[model samples]
Target: MNNTPESSFERCPVCQGSGSLRHLVTIREVPYWRCERCQCTLMDARCRLSPDDEQEVYRLHDNQPEDPGYRRFLNKLAGPLLARLAPGSEGLDFGCGPGPALAMMLREAGMQVRLFDPLFYPNHGALAGQYEFVTCTEVVEHLHHPLETFSLLDRLLKPGGLLGVMTCFQTDDSRFANWHYRRDPTHVVFYREATLQWLADHFGWVLEIPAKDVAIFRKPLSQPPVPGNG
Candidate 1:
């Protein structure tokens, strides 16, 4: 019996590259694929949970502002980001979960933060303006349309602004089947360090890995002029 996954011929959701996806693994009967172009692993679309079910999973989380443990966990991303921002930097907490603890933490550091979560604090207006920084902790894995979502993230930043992302970076394929991060039904996409670099190159942003599972991208103050006969 051939165990190989039949050719998907589907474009990679992360980088929109075609003919580069190959079956990576199946856990608990759910299929996942890895993109050769971007090194992003994505769950089969057929296995995705309904919106209501996905939201319910998020609701079960207890990441509150007062949870010292959670605060420490978030500090991995926050500490590095705070060091780079100037005083009173305006920012947005994209995909801040039910508790919005990260936003509260940043606010405590004297930064102004607006919140936006499709499930919890969905305020469309919050995305209308750009910001000096944007934090997206544990959010990229849930993106169903990464290309469009990332494009939106890019637009949400001001020139020379920072965009911070935190997700369990997919490593050690030998343990992928048992990886705790991939077991969550809502976490449909996984990124490798190479994958993050692809995003930085594609968006013309400078990339920084200040800590494990954390990536910070800085948008250029101004885009360089396209090559032309001058």
Candidate 2:
């Protein structure tokens, strides 16, 4: 039932909107982009990952936080985030991918972790519960409608919840041209700190940039003012 039309967003033709561009290197062509707002290099848009294609890739990954290497990598976000969570926190791993590694780590930390991934864990019912935290590790870059996804993540949060995200930010134009991260066709939309700031401003949430590749946004305990209301 992968009904997403291939041309829904027109493939961001100029940079191909692959969100990366290709550079002619001495040995091989390199892919990257030059962000208009941030002036950072990135990848040029390529043929997108069809829903079927994305699912295929997920089927191949095997990771769990119990794996020492996995834990070591995840703790980069988990340590700081764990410190912020209250005991018995209930949370969701929005894009758990194949192994649900982060959920495993969160559960290990005593939080009740619910997992969701459109392709693998399709228990849509989990979305019904409110969470004190939501983590989308390396997931936002693949989002087609980041605003829509963020809104849903926001709605799924109880007041004062933390939304933790991890994805490399565009830093220097020099590196983007050959950055290995862009090789994955699934990654699309790139984010700048300002992008997160814009989201925080509009939603009335507080934003924090703890790691170079991670962001944590906190939803205020009170509801944000209704749109267009003074």
On lDDT, the candidate that comes out on top is: 1
Q: What is the per-residue lDDT of model 1 for residues 1-230, given as tens digits with 9 covering 90 to 100?
A: 98766644368888888788989887777778989999999888988999999989999988788999999999999999999999999999999988999999999999999999988898999999999999999999999999789889999999999999999999889999888998888999999999999888888889999999999999999955322211
Candidate 2 C-alpha lDDT tens digits along 53-161? 9768767777865689987787778877899999889999998887888888888889998999888788799888889999989888777666668778889888999
- Write down the TM-score of every candidate: 0.95, 0.79
Q: Candidate 2: TM-score?
A: 0.79
- Best TM-score among the predictions, by candidate number: 1
Model 2 local distance difference test score: 0.70
RMSD of 1: 3.2
Determine which window of 10 residues in candidate 1 has minimal summed lDDT: 221-230
lDDT scores of the candidates, listed in order: 0.91, 0.70
Cα deviation at 142, candidate 1, in Å, is 0.5
For candidate 1, what is the TM-score? Answer: 0.95
